[model samples]
Target: MINNLFSAVSAAAAQEHFDELLRRPGLRIERIVSQGQASPTGFWYDQPQGEWVVLLSGSAGLRLAHEPSERVLSPGDFVEIPAHCRHRVEWTDTSAPTVWLAVHFDAV
Candidate 1:
């Protein structure tokens, strides 16, 4: 039995990405801690593996690719990203801290 779990601990609470988070075979996990700011303009995430994003604080807006609508997220909100679905972070809380927990894994 594995009794230990590796946790991603962030020292600063601000907007960031997973570019330097971690890497392993078929899996990646990231902790995003943010405060006040919309996502980068017109930038989207194209993932090869299915992704799951959970909001731990504040709020956000997600615009899915090819979709004409945007979804709102707040504390305790969780979303699943299917492989190959292009998506973008439209906006986020501009007055408070927003934290996110992202989990990635390959489909079997």
Candidate 2:
């Protein structure tokens, strides 16, 4: 089967959308769409699995717990977050949908 990642997105969505694309032992892939969504104040994500994510469209602000400043991510930008690394989404573009391709995997 063939599918397009940029299809079926809701531009007027009030909250971020997460779609699971594939899953297998020790690995998972997802398509995330965000529009003006951000992590709650003082909140952070600490996951057991590491994540490698790429910005496909629009832009976003990503902050790591150990970093003093947020990293601005543009289209084609990518990041690898180790397991147990605390991170948060500072913000996403409000004028357009920010598409992200995220892969979560167990550390070897």
Candidate 3:
């Protein structure tokens, strides 16, 4: 089946939307749509899998534990986060939905 990444977007959203595009052993792909969402204060993500993610549209702020400042991501911006790297989503565009493509994979 053919699919479009920008499809299935809702103009009125109260929370972030997560769509799983593909999944297999040790790997997962997802499309995330965010509107004015951020990780709760004092909370962080520590995962056992590495993640490669890209900002497909809108904008966002990402903070990593080893980084001194948050990294601002615009459309097309991408990053590779290693396993066990504590990270958080600091901010996302509120006026428009922020789209993201993320690939998570366990170390080989």
Candidate 4:
């Protein structure tokens, strides 16, 4: 049963924040669990997957590597993490569920 459609959360696109939404074969979706007030500190993964994160609820900080840019995301803001791109979090709300959606992929 799908009621309260108005209460359902949705984001059209990651305007100005995401690099590019690449959709193709061999791509996979990964689970990102950032419970409480914790985040990865400017790290890079040894893989070919780009992460596109959308802030489902609460607030969080997304810092880009080699770039002097820090984005504080609310409930609807989204971001695209490039493949092997190093990054870190500047801050996150301590009293809220910081839910996020991450999509990963490999470049051909």
Candidate 5:
């Protein structure tokens, strides 16, 4: 089967959209679409699995709990988040939808 990652995106959505692409033992992949969305104040994500995410289109701001400043991400930018590493999405492009490809897997 063939799939297009850019298809079926809704920029007018009320919240960030997540689509699971594939799942296997100890691994999963998903696509995330964000448009002018951000993490709720005082909220952070601490996941049991490690994540490797890439910005496919548009832009965003991401912050790691241990970092002093947010990292500005543009298309093609990627980040590797270790398991249990707290992080948050600070902001996303308002004029266009931001596309992200995320792979989650058990940490070695």
Candidate 6:
């Protein structure tokens, strides 16, 4: 069950790619690759589970519903999004693919 995280980068469009790296009871891990894609306008992610994510490469912009300013992320930047927090991806680096590792689990 060994695989490279950067493998299989699609070049067809500016679509984000998500790969489920691991799934177990109460936990899930994913590898996300983004290239100039972002959440749809007026769209927000309200998840029941908390998520911790880190940018492994490239850059990105994130904004929480309650936050007035957007946070730009670079390589090695990480953030914790609590359960029920509304957030969205504002942008990702278009010059290169942005790689992210995310872990989702029950908060309680």
Q: Going through the candidates in order, what is the number of backbone clashes in each?
A: 1, 0, 0, 1, 0, 0
In angstroms, give how far residue 61 of model 4 lies from its true place: 0.5
Q: Runs in model 6 with CA error above 4 Å?
A: none
Deviation of model 3 at 67, angstroms: 0.5
Q: What local lDDT score does residue 2 receive in model 6, on the 0 to 100 scale?
A: 78
**Candidate 1 vs candidate 3, lDDT winner:** 3
Q: 85-105 in candidate 1: lDDT tens per residue?
A: 889888777676567878898
Candidate 5 per-residue C-alpha lDDT over 41-86 given as tens digits, one digit per residue, 9 for 90 to 100:
9999999999999999989999999999999999999999999999
Candidate 6 lands at a TM-score of 0.93
TM-scores for candidates 1 onward, in order: 0.74, 0.98, 0.97, 0.62, 0.97, 0.93
Error of model 2, residue 37, in angstroms = 0.2
* Candidate 2 off by > 4 Å: none
Cα error of candidate 1 at position 75, Å? 0.9
- Candidate 4 structure quality by residue, lDDT tens digits, 3-31: 43124232332221222224558665433
Question: Could you tell me which residue pairs clash in candidate 4?
Answer: 42-87
Using lDDT as the yardstick, the better of models 4 and 6 is 6
Pairs that collide, model 1: 14-34
Q: Ten consecutive residues with minimal summed lDDT in candidate 2?
A: 7-16
What local lDDT score does residue 27 receive in model 1, on the 0 to 100 scale?
A: 83
lDDT of 3 by residue, 24-89 (tens): 999999999998999999999999999999999989999999999999999999999999999999
Candidate 4 backbone clash number: 1
Tens-place lDDT per residue, model 6, 6-101, is 788765355788899999998999999998999999999999999999999889999999999889999999999999999999999988889999
